[model samples]
Target: MSVCKVIVMGVSGCGKSLIGTRLAERLEVPFFDADDFHSQANVAKMASGVPLTDADRSGWLDDLAELVRVEQKGLVLACSALKRAYRDRLRAGNPSLQFVYLRGDMDTIWSRHSSREDHYFNGRTMLESQFRALQEPEPDEGAITVDVSELPDRIVERCLSALGAPDRTGES
Candidate 1:
């Protein structure tokens, strides 16, 4: 998809990885899940149901931002990006980077999360904490907000359609 950069973002288990993968395939770009970039210590903390402080996330965010900055072609990164500051961090020096917000209720996401058997972020409490930290991308942020409740194909189609026309909903 012509050097299109996008971050599929939401809480821990709102299908970021899943949808990000599909989107990347459609766009013919690489897909990276931020969970794969977490430090061992941070992964352990979340695995034990502990919420991370901003300090704990600093290095990780830097690493992701570096990846975004250095990548030569387009890519879709699946990241929680729960806070606006974190999103802004990723955007540094990568102003054209767009975001796809998987907007969903706690119950729907919790149901999807609970069914996972091998994910590191598996705590319900941690999910709640992420929601608390969430800052949905605003209209001016040049983002596409899609419902997570729909079938995956529909979501991907919506993303592709929205992407085909930038600024259709302030997404350029």
Candidate 2:
């Protein structure tokens, strides 16, 4: 089987983690939430309602990039990846890497964010900063854009279809 490396990306509250986890299960690969890679300092900054600077994110991105570099069987990564440069860092040595952008309207996402609990990204201001920093993938970037309005299962199906991945949901 060919390895499939995918980055499920978007601003917070866009359901990247939810869909990416299900997508990885369907694809029979490991799923990693980028939130796990953040430093305590970064988390604290975010918890304090401060947007992370590039310096704050560089090390975390490097660590994730390295994880991508060494995963022999491929894995699904859920990351905000709001900046083109951040995506470029992840794309560095992984030519087969593909990105799934979870695009959604601010109002829709804000509503979802408001209803969610126990997440570090709770501030509306940070969400706005994320939008300000987002650079939607260009036509040549080979990203698959999926609307976040869809259900998680449907979103995963759309992503699998777009990537030509088989639905391996029942294998064991």
Candidate 3:
């Protein structure tokens, strides 16, 4: 089996972590949550409802990219790679990186965010900024885009299907 690095990316509250975990499990590889790599300063800033600048994110992206590069096999990581430049930074060292964009309507995202509890992001404030910052992946970028409105299992199925995994639907 060819190892393939997969990034589950989208705006906050778009279920990147949940889906990425399932996809990684299905693929039998390690799963990473990029949010876990954020510095204490960045976390505190976001907790206070501040949007991160590119400078704030550069180090984090570099860390994620380096993690991917060092892993001999592929893995799945969940990140809110809101900007093209950030995504590029992640792809800089790991040329084989592939993205799985979790696309959803803003209303759905906001609704999900609003209901969540004990998270750093201020749903009301951050949602707008995330949308503002997001640069949708280009059609030619070779990243698979998935509509996140579907069931979680179905989303994993779609991701694996896109990755050319043999049909493991019934078993899982």
C-alpha TM-score for every candidate:
0.93, 0.96, 0.96
Ranking by lDDT: 2, 3, 1
Model 3's lDDT to the true fold?
Answer: 0.89
Whole-model lDDT per candidate? 0.89, 0.92, 0.89
Q: Pick the candidate with the highest TM-score.
A: 3
Going through the candidates in the order shown, the clash numbers are: 1, 0, 0
Task: Please provide, for model 2 over 35-97, each residue's C-alpha lDDT reduced to its tens digit, 9 standing for 90 to 100.
Answer: 999999999889889999999999999999999889889899999999889999999998899
lDDT of 1 by residue, 30-139 (tens): 99999899999999999999999999999999999999888878889999898889999999999989899999999999998998998788588999999999998877
lDDT of 3 at 72: 77
